[model samples]
Target: ETVIYRIYYYINRSGTGHLTLRELKRGNLIDAMLHCDEEEDINKVLRYFSYEHFYVIYCKFWELDTDHDFLIDKENLIRYGNHALTYRIVDRIFSQVPRKFTSKVEGNMGYEDFVYFILAEEDKSSEPSLEYWFKCIDLDGNGVLTRNEMQFFYEEQLHRMECMAQEPVLFEDILCQMIDMIKPQLVKTDYFTCLTIEISCLQDESYIMLRDLKGSKLSGSVFNILFNLNKFMAFETRDPFLIRQERENPTLTEWDRFAHREYIRLSMEDDVEDASNGSAEVWDESLEAPF
Candidate 1:
């Protein structure tokens, strides 16, 4: 309990004690963490802080398990045809998770897999997440992403960008940019140091929003579609009733912080409504037997 609060404090604004949709709309987790000098050290802190999202992730797992069969099928992921959830993103997910780890050949994901997907999406800097995506990007499973594999993902990204009628980006230029970001240091590089910097910038100063880069929609979304949705809600949505409004530090990843706050908000609303309804029921049954 104490540990969770300690983590939650750093992950959220201190005055608010947890993230609010308002603060998230202004910026993202990186903005909060970068107020400090060392991003690499902040990344390390985030890796051990997964426990901060334990509650929301558990709640969401069951929510995605539509069949009550203790698994999330492709149909579950495609729920209601939400436009932000693209087919390519969902398809790649099943293709990546090992068959042995999945619940069925039909590509159903169990709770553990769902958690891995969320962690990978929310904290690409984490070792578990970095390796999880490495497995996916390394389609051939030969321990590295070959030219063909890069082409494969890039082709889909290009197609999606074109379909959206956004200006097309020259594949060559994008490739050069990616190469530099992924392997910036030729000697003793931390490898993933800046790889995720551009790919998973969920803060308001996002690489996508800043550069307005085409196909950046799924730059990291192919790894998890919900990631994009969380960003949309955090950055685009405003507080309807002017709820709690303040800011401090950012400890949780933007997606994790967003989901956690949404869960708490909905839960509190339910409690208030339930209490009123219970009181009304008691008054109406006042004449009935207590037994």
Candidate 2:
């Protein structure tokens, strides 16, 4: 079933204020859980969903809302349902454990325990992948990365070409510089990808352009904050005139402005013309610009 139906209908209809085994059963958790023929597959799905819930909450806190309203959003509701469904499946699989297998039995575990278990599992799985990168950077087949090796690599490859470009000596300064470089790159890449996708779908080009202009203005506002970090963050200080100029001035040239003004003047020459074109979209203000 689609996430929308699961969130909007099944879970909501279950009327459970919080997720429980009973609620999970009523939510039709079995259908949502992916088919797993092995014990490892069951564990993987359980850990994956638990991690997903934690990550979703983390992202919502960091990027969307700190007050927890993100939990109420439709997207988050779907995510919560998915995780809850996975948890139910894992619980069911554990329920099948024989009474004789006392050592393998997991006692009544709450959501928090499940979350922590997922995190531990992820940390264990990540170690082997990092080992490969460690080996590649070890250079002399040394078992570990050394200070001298790291310094040599940094100076030879990572150093700036400009002699005036000094390395950031402080950890906080280095972190801030890294954020400055990374944030804009992420934004630009996202913006370009979104534009490409929208264009590919044959969306209205003019509307897309307007949306892009709005996004550019928002980005400029964000840039102003980074540029003037020492100043107080204020919403009302943005220059409206500069924003308007940026939006409209790109398409206007001296000749176009002149001709546009003439066309508007001709259209509004008399009351008869204005009455006849009452429903028409007017472009008088755009035409009257001084260029």
Candidate 3:
């Protein structure tokens, strides 16, 4: 038995009476039905009424068991068509939903998931830089961050170093500044204790002596220097002496007390200014304060 299915589409335009699919295809439709003031106006109407509607009808026909209506089960046709139509309507509605609302829905997930995902994908071959540390700290795969994991890692590393050595060297203020520069999102949390420990471990000579410290401690200001200098040096292309000289010049304008302290202040500032306002230029160590 061959089933012949007739698919009908109807379009309602304001100027003319209702237009049927047959009338449209045959060019027998009234002048008012064909009359569109602009090409865009006609295209929009055709897209929604003819093209999209035809696609929906075709999908429904494809899902049917037979082509002949007489041989087809009436109840099954109604059920399948109605189900597909319902889903299509739902997709259209969701597509139109505002982005702000969608983001709010997605934002409820745990931050740990976000950080972990990022860490898992990180490239190990690249230099073990701050970005590498960042990938590790992001325990969850999500791009947005939370402070607990990062602070815990930093604190644990600091504690390990402190346990090896008896005294502190890194200044609390300098540690806070480093946190601000390295992980701004994590800096917002009340986990400054770990940051303080990291700075102390880095600065204290006695602590380094306890572990048989092998690396230079005073290469750069605490705020500007990376904790893993060895990793940075591995990939750096510049001359080692030039880099060392830059760090050695205590009188350099950028290393000045105000430069270092001001950098810290800018990172901690709650009300962020626009980029156009220009960040305080890197500090000059040589500029003497009037005081």
Candidate with best lDDT:
1
lDDT of each: 0.47, 0.31, 0.30
What are the runs in model 3 whose C-alpha is more than 4 Å off? 1-132, 169-175, 180-242, 245-291
65 Cα displacement, candidate 2 (Å): 36
What is the Cα-based TM-score of model 3? 0.21
Clashing pairs in 1: 10-251, 11-251, 11-252
lDDT, model 2: 0.31
Residue 134 Cα positional deviation in candidate 3, in Å, after optimal superposition: 2.5
lDDT of 2 by residue, 1-291 (tens): 122222322243333335567656665456545433334433233322323233332332223222332222223222332222122223322342211111222343322222222222222122221232233334444232333333433332222212336332333342243234323222334345554433322321211122222233232222212211111023234457534653787654222332344345444554555778765445344322110
Cα shift from native, residue 124, model 2 (Å): 10
Alpha-carbon runs more than 4 Å astray in model 1: 1-52, 78-89, 96-99, 102-106, 184-261, 264-291
Give, for candidate 2, the lowest lDDT window spanning 10 residues: 223-232
> What TM-score against the true fold does each predicted structure earn?
0.50, 0.18, 0.21
**Which 10 consecutive positions of candidate 3 have the poorest summed lDDT?**
1-10
Alpha-carbon RMSD to native, per candidate: 13.6, 27.4, 29.9
lDDT of 1 by residue, 103-138 (tens): 554567766566556655555443334455555655
